[model samples]
Target chain A: MKLGDPRKAYRIAQGAKVRLNEDDAADMSLCPEGGKNSTQGLFDSLRDRIQTLQKVLYAENKRRVLVIIQAMDTGGKDGCVKHVFSRVDPQGVNVKAFKKPTEDELAHDFLWRVHPHVPGNGEIVIFNRSHYEDIIAVRVKKLLPESVWKKRYQHVLDFERMLAEEGTTIVKLFLHISKDEQKRRLEKRLENPAKHWKFHVDDLADRKRWHDFTGAYEDLIERTSTDYAPWFVIPADRKWYRNLCVAKLFADTLEDLELNFPERDFDPSSIRIDD
Target chain B: MKLGDPRKAYRIAQGAKVRLNEDDAADMSLCPEGGKNSTQGLFDSLRDRIQTLQKVLYAENKRRVLVIIQAMDTGGKDGCVKHVFSRVDPQGVNVKAFKKPTEDELAHDFLWRVHPHVPGNGEIVIFNRSHYEDIIAVRVKKLLPESVWKKRYQHVLDFERMLAEEGTTIVKLFLHISKDEQKRRLEKRLENPAKHWKFHVDDLADRKRWHDFTGAYEDLIERTSTDYAPWFVIPADRKWYRNLCVAKLFADTLEDLELNFPERDFDPSSIRIDD
Candidate 1:
């Protein structure tokens, strides 16, 4: 569970079984006890780098980045987003939270509801939950037949590959948290006076079928983790470690692109005022 | 000119001549000399009111507000927007700036480029420059014949009426600035090293056609300022006064709605958590 080489270590192996229960929930070596100060120092440096990279991406207006985050209940997706992307200008980033599909959305093809939310040139788009739900949710709940739902994995791969060919950098993250920790978090949501509004009876029903959902995620991570669009399974019981891992991945992805300040279109010396 | 009774004072007269040069550019009587302090006090108060009202609007999720601001070059449209809307939540408000229409946009009816940007339920959308530009820009530059452009005033009125009937409160403001003031601002944009990038060569050509453009705006303000959606001819010579006046209009408009918190769908006294 050491996050030594996140790109290689944490990325889900192509053909290996993703046993969600087997993974360590809290890796203390990655995040030492009482380590908020040291973790925040690394986070600040990484966050500042993302802010600068985002500006260059905006100015270049050539490449697009889409970050898709999927998580179990109370798995800290929001916290990871806030800490990692807080420094980037809101104008440059568009966050779309995919809720239950509307009646109109249901009428269209599944990707139809998701396609329009994709990032445009020089933009960064974060999908809080995304098209992957078509496979996992439907499969877990038997919303669609096995024949229909199984084909979506290939469709998802093709759609993402087309986007890559057209200049979109896709990064998908499946935040990994233990089931026992999820119960703790969900119980906290009900116990905290301020968090009563966040709880739903349906979450309890989903938690009851936790093993089924894990099996669905297991297949999802194995089948859809393409070379062009890899899925990173981050250790998420520790919020600080999750933030650092996500931020570092983003910084590395951006830096690897070799972004440079765009060449000026006009000569600065020629801007003479007649007045 | 005093800015008292802004809803009554600044709302353009239905049949009055909107002679740009003849209108008061410096409404200093409303703001005393060296009185930025007092003007800011009024602005701060109004801005805070807008912030509160906007949250109520979001909570109620019923009505929508669309603020259309049209101004000539260096006419303080951006300044007016920033000062008036500085305190509102970025999520609750949307700002859309219409630049030169692309070829795809020009292929459709003029309103085609605008209709998609309209406010949705419980939202406030500000159009920095809007479909009114179809009437003003093309009419001034003779991009289209009079036969084509003349028909659009009725089209504009009809569009605004439909929006009004559909629970959207539309406030269109014509930021009124004198030609002399525009020249001074444009000169500043060219002379200031930091602002050199904002200066464009086409702006000089547009400045030369100031009189022709005013005539176009004159007809636009007269024909389209209807009861359903009135145009406010804000005196833009003084930036702080313009901000205060616009903020007051928005605050008054929201206050008139008598917005209340939406009735809760669930009881807070429900069964306690087992945890």
Candidate 2:
């Protein structure tokens, strides 16, 4: 039950997926409808801890954190980034959302564009979607030969190793949503007029290739979960649980870094006595 | 007294310089240290309102906001951004801090580097220091020809006019602190063993040129205060008042935008009965 030592813990979490049950699901649903009163106590308590750790971890320990999130559509990547990071000290955090590569990015190697945006010392950087996209997109569309796509796994591990050597701690999360849950969510979007804006034919296209995408993800989790940068497969069927796990992981990492607040010095006796 | 209007009120506030009396200063000092209690009430009432308004403003009214901040070294620009924006919905807001130009940025016109970061429709962008740096740095170090730097005022005015025509609302703040206060803060930093790393020799060089910098700031504020993007001179000697004024301006602006949450199609009765 203890998620100890990043690499070993990651493997156990991944393998323990088959053992996940209703209790975990119930715990995730701790967040209630209003999203205000129901979860306020948990988030508020954690928020204070996060603030204190952030100040110390950033200004003193100066550890750099890299968060990698890969998920199926409507799996709540945006929501996770926003809500979990709601209490972060922004000065030491940078969130980068990578979409389709621009022409300039195309000019360089895949890792080149990503290198510059990596968190500096005592900083936290979140990649909404990252280099893993290269594997997913290429695998789904057959954009590359099998040999070519397979080679990228080693390249990624090596890239992450470089980052670890440079003092970057990486947390990669794969939001695992069931096919049936996805279908229900998609139908809800289609049934509503206002929500129709979010639905697209391409979503259905991706769903049709669900098996291939799952295989790609399975391979991804197996191949790239290294000692330096490990992956967590979080069940994202319920959003409340997703937020809790993500928040816990972030706080735990800062605790691992042993954050301390910067000390202040002032002469208390310098003030004049009252007449 | 009304600092809310975009035109006439700006002119009036610009004409009058108000100083806080000792009693007023004493009363305002009671505002929370570190911005925790100072703006608590304001945040509680306006948090939900701002959230609902953000989406509507993004979809319907679509106004762009450009916030320009001017301050001395360690005047809390970073702290203000971190605390004041801690509650905002990020989909509509962006923060840009200007540092020394990179090689590519130096090759182009200085404004060229800044023009790209300006707010687009439905965006609220914060500029930590802005194109006015050309004037400030140039005036102090004589980095550019007087003719070139002087001409930038007219250029900046024209650029802002273009943004206003395109629906960008501008807010500029100059965080003003006395030399005595700066000396006290800097001396405290030097005396603090924990803060030794934060103190840089370069900062002392800038502090020695305090008179020159103040003169430059006076001229820049006098000339650049206009109907559009008028500057609010805030007392930086007290951090709480600065946060209060900034929060007030933000709340008032969103209210003016009249943002409302979109209606969801989910059946209210279905949930009510089940619950």
Best by DockQ: 2
DockQ per candidate: 0.15, 0.20
Identify the candidate with maximal lDDT. Answer: 1
| Model 2 regions lying over 4 Å from their true place | A1-42, A102-109, A143-148, A187-197, A259-275, B1-39, B56-64, B90-92, B100-108, B112-123, B143-145, B158-168, B180-205, B226-228, B255-275
CAPRI class of candidate 2: incorrect
Each prediction's TM-score against the native?
0.77, 0.77
lDDT of 2 by residue, A1-275 (tens): 12223223323342233333323322343343554346556655666777677777666745688989898877778778778776665555667777778888877777777887788777778888998988887788897687877888988989999899988898898777777667777777666555554555667678878777877887788778766787877767777667766776677777887766555333433422121
Clashing pairs in 2: A28-A241, A62-A122
Fnat by candidate, in order: 0.01, 0.12
The candidate 2 chain B region of ten consecutive residues with least summed lDDT is B1-10
- Residue by residue across B1-275, what tens digits does model 2's lDDT show? 12232222222254344442223221243233445454567655555555565656655435778888878876768767776776655545667778777889878887998887787766678888989898898778888889888888778888888887888888787777766666676676676665554655567678778778877877777777777768766666766555655666666776776654344435422421100
